[model samples]
Target: MAFDIYDFTSLTSSIHEGLATFLPPVGVLIAEWLLVGISVLLFVAVFGLILVYLERKVCALFQQRLGPMRVGKWGLLQTIADFIKLLMKELITPNKADKFLYNLAPFIVIIVTFMAIAAIPFAKGLQAIDFDIGVLYVSSVSSLGVIGVLLAGWSSNNKYSLIGAMRSGAQIISYELSVGMSLITMIILAGSMQISEIIQAQSTGWFIFTGHIPAVIAFIVFLIAGTAETNRGPFDLAEAESELTAGFHTEYSGIKFAFFFLAEYVNLFIVSAMATVLFLGGWMPFHVGSLDGFNAVMDFIPPIFWFFGKVMFVIFLIMWFKWTFPRLRIDQILTLEWKYLLPVNLLNILLMTLIVLMGWHF
Candidate 1:
């Protein structure tokens, strides 16, 4: 087979075959599992630092102020310094907190993030696990993080923490419907839940363009719902610093707190990645009909870059929402979802179904 640096399939297959040649079948399985675990751990650690730095810079740009100039060139090492500090700090638990559940919450939250990340396709054949029900698998796993939030808050024995956790649970539960309906709308259009197949269906053109108005609506709803699901700002009633201090993880300190912090940025990445795969065509290069020259130029860029470029664009939009909007009142947040987004999302789903039935979509 011809080598393509952009596609990871050949590299991964060769590794597997080479290992099989020297190792027993069980040993091969064990080796692959070890490799995957280490890769995920390393990626999470490095990407978490990058995202924290990116968020600082992005927020600085919005506010017209310098960010992170003291640590390294342009303060690039700031997050790494902070990470090291967190690692050295003490993991403090509240004296009154339930020790077992309190300690378990952060692990639960971060583990769910890793599980959801496994299903996302970073590039061709680069995914850790590819289930037929990839979308459903992701949705189910990602939603479990809220349980950890609740556990942290309730186990802390703090009223503020409990309130924040309760708020997060309600917020995530409500907005999840909008997120699912948006994906279902696309699934109706694409006719597959497998993430790879969904991307392949966009070989000619992205669904956002081909599916037209309904696709646009679903995209909007998905972004809004995704932000809410991640407990991010504008919908961050759960983490109202003025009202609830540090919210659900208030009692957590040191590396435990870092886990929660890391999970937030990683969750942000996952949400953007899902948006990219569903509406922005995953790793597929952009193409305009009958423009072979332009299409060929686009294809010259690696698929992995296309995938991450789209992911970063969507991440910026989510970050913009975070920095720009005022946090909504808890009631307003719930009302926005139940009254406005949810109803519009339900209608949008029906519209997409009709479009599919009538063959109106490209």
Candidate 2:
């Protein structure tokens, strides 16, 4: 039988039927859930390693230095080595630390990331969960990571950790408004929050191109705010090494530390994937108007590749911000969100509303 790579739902349905052939209904359901959980976990682990390697190389390129060249053929195994090292390290809890919350913090952070990942559409029918309000779901779910960060800091009983976590809370809280406003702007233009429907709406052209200036503004704002939301560099005041000595997770070690580390990269992926879906048209091939021949060629490249290509491009842009810019002081970070991004985002939303109402957007 010829395989149709584009029809992910068919593949998943076949698996469901196969499971049901022998197992009872409840057993099938449990089996499917277990499979999904395992698949997502594996994807997270592998993707985290790839992102770490990618970041190292990206940072090296920006600084004109070679990175991780000695480990397994262009340093392909460097991340794996690091993972093993982290696994073997000691898990230490300070005597004064609040043991329960301290241990639970990293799990909360990582689990939140996994939950957000479930909503993202990697390719056609490849999404884990297709909520009617996917945009709202992702935005709301991703913001909960701050609770874990706060817990890690307060429970650690370390002053520097507490200060760092406080900065993170303030940073995420301030930028989250901009992130929501930017998404709201696009949600206005798109008219529906369903991820698949939004992609289908872009069959003519991506929102970034068709919605023009307002769409462009929202995309830019989303990128900026998303970076802050992920607690990435420049906005990474949460883990500002120079100021707070490893920040909120300072007291965590071994796999606990690895959980915090892996969550960071996976969150970065989620942000990039969200940007791709909202602006670039998730899994949609690039098509130039009135150019059927060119578009047909693009269609041959496969939707999954198109999705990942756009995701990687956005990831590169975020990484560029990290390597090119100086880390902002916490005050400056808050000021950028409150004094600048928030006001512009408000006006942008209003403009988008007008555009949608007037049918000004193509």
Candidate 3:
């Protein structure tokens, strides 16, 4: 059967009914729990693999090269090979490092990333958890990633690692303001924080289109903030190889290092997906105003395709920033955030509020 967002609620009601028919209620409950847990685990594992491969290919295409060509046709097996390599490699800890924290940091980062995926609506009625505070939940859960980075950096006891952690912490805090404000504008327009409701609000037209000028401004700010939040591209001073020598997890090796790397890419996917959901309309077909045929043609494509297409488009823009721009110095990075983005984003939010109040949106 296809994934159903309402399955958990339905399952709960079913369990109650099952109790009336069966003598051993405990067994049925246990079985259902196991099934749900296993399904979530499998979904995460598969999604992680596919996302990694897709990112590689996307990056490759932008750089005028083939990403993966050997393992599976067009290098599809590259990530699998990388996974095996990580698994086979020996885990190493520095002599002076806090062994416990060093090993735990990666898992913490991965856990936070995986948790945020639960609220993402893959398609109509396909979300894992449909909470009222879905947007806020995502923002809160994502911020926890910086903790893991800091732990890894501090525990490693390397100067570069420490600097990387500091930079990451600062960057995340700075960008989070703009990202949150951008999301706030969407929430204000939608009049709800639920991911499903947000998507529904875009049924008539995506927020990017409806909110018009202010929405476009917020979108750009969000994109920039998100890129920095994920520690990608020009804002990736935390991992600047020429400066920090691999950044926060510099001393980590084998599976430990792999965890940090995985977390980074996973965060990238999350940010892109969030952008798709908030501005481009998650799982909603594109519609040109008053173009019935075009809208119908768009609807023929599955919601998931629209969702992924928008995400990939955002990802391409991110990769473009990465390849085209030079890395900003740490001081310059802070200055850009406080001096430019913060002020512009604050003004954008005010303008958005005015636009919404004036009913200027189409």
Pairs that collide in candidate 3 are: 5-125, 68-74, 68-75, 69-75
Worst lDDT window (10 residues) for model 1? Answer: 1-10
User: What is the C-alpha local distance difference test score of each model?
Assistant: 0.94, 0.92, 0.84
The full ranking of all candidates by lDDT, starting with the best, is 1, 2, 3
Question: How do the residues 249-294 of candidate 1 rate in per-residue lDDT, one tens digit apiece?
Answer: 8888899999999999999999999999999999999999989999
Q: List the residue pairs that clash in candidate 2.
A: none
Q: lDDT of model 3 at residue 142?
A: 96
Q: In model 1, which regions exceed 4 Å deviation?
A: 1-3
lDDT of 2 by residue, 23-105 (tens): 99999999988998998999999999999999999999999998899999999999999999999999999989999999999
List, residue by residue over 1-362, the lDDT tens digit for candidate 3: 23333233454556557654774678767776565567656766666677788777877887799888899788888888998888898888888999898888999998898888878887775576789999999999999999999999999979999999999899998888888988997888888999999998898899999999988988998889999999987999898999999999889878778778877877888898899999999988988889999999988887877887888788878878887789988789888889998888788878888888988888
Instruction: Please report the candidate that would top lDDT against the real structure.
Output: 1
What's the lDDT of the predicted structure labeled candidate 3? 0.84
The clash numbers for all candidates, in the given order, read: 0, 0, 4
- Each candidate: RMSD to true structure? 1.1, 1.0, 3.0
